[model samples]
Target: RFGDKFIRVSFSIPTPEVERFVDAFPKVMAEL
Candidate 1:
């Protein structure tokens, strides 16, 4: 039960690195 809860929280967490990567992707592609 505890492990399942941890997994849920992990998936729920928003990661800034991912957000930054996503935000930069379009500019990088546009330059190509």
Candidate 2:
């Protein structure tokens, strides 16, 4: 899923952004 790409990028992003991304990750994975 596209979530994989986001996961890969999430680590390279800033902490705040990664936190937000992590927060949303569960919902995204659930949707998949």
Give me the candidate number with maximum lDDT.
2
For candidate 1, the lDDT comes to 0.72
lDDT of each residue in 1-32, candidate 1, tens digit only:
96697567656768785566568868988999
lDDT, residue 13, candidate 1: 61
lDDT (C-alpha, whole model) for all candidates? 0.72, 0.86
Q: Residue 4 deviation, candidate 1, in Å? A: 26
Native-referenced Cα lDDT, model 2: 0.86
Error of 1 at 32 (Å): 0.5
TM-score of 1: 0.53
- List candidate 1 segments past 4 Å from native: 1-14
Tally clashes: model 1: 0
- In order, how many clashes per candidate? 0, 0
Q: State the lDDT of candidate 2 residue by residue for 1-32, as single tens digits.
A: 87698778977899998898789978988999
